[model samples]
Target: MFLNNDLGPTLEKIFNDSDSLKSLSIALGNASIQNAQIIMGTVEISNISDLHQFVQCTVNFTSLTVELDDGAWVCVGPCQKNPNFCNQQGACQNEINGPHCKCHSSYFEKYYGAQCELYSRGAGFYAVLFGCLVAFALLIIVSAVMIVVFYRAKRTSSKKFELFEDDFFDFTSRGGYGHQNFSVTEDSINTTATEVTDEQR
Candidate 1:
């Protein structure tokens, strides 16, 4: 049973053989399955900094007292109280030594501390970094392939154009089409002239 603020003598205790209850007095500051059996069966003395040895919720077997203040009892592990002692995003866990904070996600963002507050890097971060590097490498390779293909295609086209120019030569060059034989010989010209003179005579 957790006795909180009203650590007073207002309640009576009765023991019977027919129906009996036995209790042990021990100090625990954090919540646990074993401690949380009753009202989150954890007790804490909330004051620390001022060197104030006691708080309002102090209790003993014969009496109870409450001197309420800001530093009143709030349960933590045997030595702590504030659950957010483990940063806001972490869950406070009771360990044998003291309270520990477990991070919500270890893969994406690493958290480490007594309260799980400090971090360096996580596995997910490294994965993303690696993925980005691979993508960049692939992009460079593809660009290089495209450039090589374009250059080869351009070079091949230029060679084909040079061959076509050589085959055409030029209309006015030494091998022009007009230089080939396409008219009659001198013997035919003389025969025609003689026949004309005979007709005239």
Candidate 2:
């Protein structure tokens, strides 16, 4: 509907009211400019999301001018027509109609647009990875704490056993009523000697 030169001035009016267009592409054939030069290529646009944005694209002889960043773009593609197709945001796929941009997915971001120029970084993917790392760290910490506590408790038990052994053997050093120390005397030998002499005499 937009290709008709008869539609003419309605181009600005029709596109200026873009309310729901995410992407747009236009190719002009035998399109004439009244007094100005001619454009031989297509115009492509990756517009603002859910907002009205306008860009001007024009071609004069060999010099081409178009919106580079925001609005109307006079560049078109079929993959091989432009090496930097899809703005390098995605790989270009040549279809029967033209080139289609296949947006690539990443762990941290999702892409939009045929150029894949528009994107929103997602936290969910990175959040899950970060959460796993945190969980692993906590597990390591808990394991280390348990090992230290076990070794400390074992060392304390050994010290208690040593103290118990010392206390148990300490009783042998003190005298008790059940224990006695005796002395062997020389008088018994003297009595035996005297009896032997008397028997001999």
Candidate 3:
């Protein structure tokens, strides 16, 4: 009579007790059914927390149970608020190394701005340098052309002046004097000289 009362007669009532026993059974069964082991962990405190912090929390589980059904075992580790721990392109509060951010090797983080950002080599650096070089080259080419043109022009002008001086001197001498007396006197002297020579002979 007492045993009957202790075990409830109703199926719903019995199931309520059975469910609680099944949870314990499952936990115990998981250890033997799959190869499982506990994970060890440690923590570092950068600043003392005013609120309570977790020393450790552990739960029994089958470590060998493939999570994705592809032979990869479940991961057991300390709890973290951020999910981007393993992502190379993402940042997380749970970053293993540096601050609460994770950056790819090619990137860097600025302390004042966005926690994680891509480092950029500014376009202005190349633009200014290249612009200066182009300007310098243009200046050199223009200067060289100007020097060549100036020298050629000076040489041509000097030659022209020399020609003009020679022409002026020739025109100002006897041929350009245009005097009729000078020619007549020169011809009479020539004739007198010839007569004297003849008389002497």
Overall lDDT per candidate, in order of appearance: 0.58, 0.61, 0.49
lDDT of 3: 0.49
Q: In model 3, which runs have C-alpha deviations exceeding 4 angstroms?
A: 1-120, 171-201
- Arrange candidates, best TM-score first: 1, 2, 3
Listed in order, each prediction's TM-score against the native is: 0.47, 0.38, 0.32
What residue runs in model 1 are displaced by over 4 Å at the alpha carbon? 1-83, 94-97, 171-201
Q: For candidate 1, what is the total of clashing residue pairs?
A: 6
| TM-score winner | 1
lDDT string for model 3 (89-168, tens) is: 54443223333454444222222223444455446666777999999999999999999999999999998888777456
**Residue-by-residue lDDT tens digits, candidate 1, 78-191:** 223464676776786665455567766677787777667787777888999999999999999999999999999999999888877844765556656534656898999999
- Model 3 clashing-pair count: 0
Tell me the deviation in Å of residue 201 in model 3: 42
User: What ranges in model 2 sit over 4 Å off?
Assistant: 1-78, 93-100, 106-109, 118-124, 165-167, 172-201
